[model samples]
Target: MKANVWHGKNKLQVDNVPDPTILNPRDAILKITSTAICGSDLHLLDGYVPTMEKGDILGHEFMGEVVELGSAVTNLKIGDRVVVPFTISCGHCLSCEEKLYSLCENSNPNAWMAEKMWGHSPAGIFGYSHLTGGYAGGQAEYVRVPYADVGCFKVPNDMSDDQVLFLSDILPTGWMAAENCSIEPGDVVAIWGCGPVGLFAIQSAFVQGAERVIAIDRFPERLRMAKKLRAETLNYEEVSVLEALKQLTGGRGPDACIDAVGMEAHGVGMVGAYDTIKQAVRMESDRPIALREAMMACRNGGTVSVPGVYGGLIDKVPFGSVMNRSLTIKTGQTHVQRYMQPLLERIQKGEIDTTCIITHHLPLDEAPHGYDLFKNKQDECIKVVLKP
Candidate 1:
């Protein structure tokens, strides 16, 4: 089977790897049909996340047909089309019982490693890194899904793979981000970054009854997409985002602010340059310009929601502003399982369209070029779907 394998920093290759088989009684083998490159994948590709090994498979958002199932799996059978959540969970665990699937205590085979970093282990994620689970990702012809009964959501026959695939991650992530904001009716929301997650955040805010959404990004293409969704956009490169947001919100700032651009945020001045220098010198693990700006730009009592992926320690966050303004902050990896069925129902009901973000589709073999195109923002790439 050909899989996208990670080599080193800024390196990914399509290589022939052995096909996967059921490794546990609750496992199932899936024949992957569609997979996507996530913005978070760039963190791994750029050597931001640690505990990665060479030859690791690199994808998380994917959906496909079940080819085989282990003896204990009963919820699904052969030939069932399903979209698996990125977070691997055991249904009966405390976190899983509470519907916090991403924080499941039993999924990560490498819990100890994560414990060393964060004092606890979260769920193992597909194709993330050894820190998450060391599980091979779905960016291949086939993948082995563990805890199959709990993780795989059966896709309705009427829906196309493209329609439900993002339920595996970003769609749910965006929804969860918005939900965390607790938007009241007629509230104004400001989102940083117009990437897929940010765009989805905009849509989700509206779904949650936000009256206005302001999307900030430097890319005209991305900002244009936000406009199509009825969001006001700000080009951070062309204008002072904080000032413009203040003006637009009548000096109150947005009722809620979202930081959708995580570790790789770009700013127009010395702050961005300083972060770059710190990241280059290993003095800071992530760039927090977007997060800092979000904190500072939020209304005095507003919420700050973050769906962006940040892997490590950040430098120079404005804690004073966060505390002085009595801001509320919420963020985490999406509990994909919790939102999978709900978001799928929305898709089925014509409430939202998830396919608009797909800007490129390619065979699995061209994954290297796909990564380059997405990372460089080349050809206005917003998302890439890989078919195996």
Candidate 2:
């Protein structure tokens, strides 16, 4: 099988790799039918992550068919079409029982982290690096799914791949982001970063009953998507986001703020989107922009939710702003399993077309092309799925 391998900073290689077989009684082998690149993958691609040994497979978001299942894997069967959650977890762990699958204690020991927790380090990641669980990912022809019974969800046969694929990651992550905001029916929410996750957060906000959603980003296509979805958009290029938001909100700010940009936010410090902050905390920062914006725009005591991924830290956050505003901060990766059934129901009801975000599709052998387009934001690409 050929997989997208992260060789180094700004370097990706399509390499032939070995196929996977069931390694545990709870595991299954999946034939990756469709896979997409995520922003977190960029961290590894740009060398922002550590211990990325050469030839590490480089993808996490995907859906596939079960080719083989271990004897103990009772919830799934061979020939079942399923979407694999990015987090590899044992179903019975304390965290897993609580639906915090990302924090599962028995998560793949051989996958990413041998000595850390989900909120810390590269504990368990797919094909990106060795610091993560060192697990080969779905960018290839075959992947070994650890904790298969709990990790893979069967995709409805009538649904398209794009329809159910995001249930693997973004849909749930966006839900996590929106839920963090504690949105009320009449609340207005502001989101920074128009990436797929950010877009999902915007949609999720509406689903959660936010009356107004203000999506902030510099990208034209993404901003347009926000408008089409009936949300207000801040270009961050045309006018001052905070000032404009404050003016629009009657000087109070949004009711809830979400930072989907994470550490990748551009033009920090409000000096215009071009002025980079002196230093950035290299971890999840729905804070830098959304937190600050929310403090200034949210109606005093609004909530701030962060579903963006972050790691290895530095720099001090403006804790005072958040404290003075009495802002609530919610942050985490999606506990996808818990939200899957509900989200699937929504999809079945024609609520949101999650697959509409897919801007490109390529053969699994062209995994490199998908990565290039998605990494550079080229081709107006928001998401690119590789098909086997």
Candidate 3:
């Protein structure tokens, strides 16, 4: 098998690797057909997330056919096409019973390491880092899936891979972010970042009954995509984002603000430079530019929904404003299993076209190039799908 292996920061290579075999009674092996480069993958690529070792396979959003299955996996068999959620969960846990799959206690074998960092362990994530379970990712020709009966969602025969692949991560992530907003009828939602997740957040906000959405980003192509979804656009580079939100909402801030841009957010002027310097000197692990703005821009008593990925401690968070304004903060790794079937139904009904954000397609061998393209936002690329 050939996989995209991580060597070091800013280094990746397509290398031949041993094929995976079923290691657990609930495990299965998938022959990957389609996989994608997610925004969070860049965190590993740039060394933001810790515990990533050399030779680790890198990708989580993937779908494929079951080439083999273990005896305990009664619900699926050979030839079943499935979309595997990035969060690996055991079906019988309390967290799983409560439908908070990402918080499943039995998934991460590296839980103690995570406990040292976050005080508690979340679910193990495929191909993320050693902080999560070091499960091999699906960015290869084939990979093993643990707790297959719970993690793998069988894809309907009628839907295409491009239409369903995102169910593994970003689509459900966007939906969950919007759901966190607790949008009311005729309410306005503001979102930062115009990347894939941000674009989906814009669309999902509309689906959740938001009367209007405001999108913020510096990319013209991404802003255009938001416009296509009928969201008003603001280029953060062109105007004061706080003032713009104030003016747009007629003196009141937006009802909710979504920070879709995670730790690597590009800041402007001294603030941006400060985060850059702090991160470079190991004073901080993440840049909270978007989060700070979201907290400040949200209306009093409103929600601040974060779908973005943050790997470690951040500096200078505006806790004063969040506390003073009584803002409700909601965020987590998406409980993908909770939303997969519902969002798939939406795709089947043609309510959400997941294919609209795909901007580049590459062979699995060219994954290095694909990563470069997405990381740099080159070629107007919004998303990159790799065919294995």
lDDT of model number 3: 0.90
TM-score of each: 0.95, 0.90, 0.95
Expressed as tens digits, the lDDT of each residue in 1-388 for candidate 1 is: 9999999878899999999987889999999999999998988887777567999999998999999999999889999999989989998999999999999999999898777666688999999988899999999999999999998899889889889899999999899999999999999999998999999999999999999999998888999999999999999878888899999999999999999998787322111121233332233333337898999999999999989887655667899999998999999998888888779888888777799999999999999999999999999999999999
Per-model tally of clashing residue pairs: 0, 15, 0
Candidate 3 least-lDDT 10 residues: 266-275
lDDT winner, 2 or 3: 3
Question: Which 10 successive residues of model 1 have the least lDDT summed?
Answer: 266-275
Overall lDDT per candidate, in order of appearance = 0.88, 0.76, 0.90
Model 2 lDDT tens row, 259-341:
78764652221111112222332434342354455455666788878776664433445678778878777887677788888
Pairs that collide, model 3: none
lDDT of 3 by residue, 1-388 (tens): 9999999979999999999999899999999999999998988898776578899999999999999999999999899999999999997999999999999999999998777667799999999988898888989999899999998999889889999999999999999999999999999999999999999999899999999999999989999999999999999888889999999999899999999998777322111121233333233323337988999999999999999987665657789999998999999999999999999999998888799999998999999999999999899999999998
TM match of model 1 to true structure: 0.95
By the lDDT metric, which is better: model 1 or model 2? 1
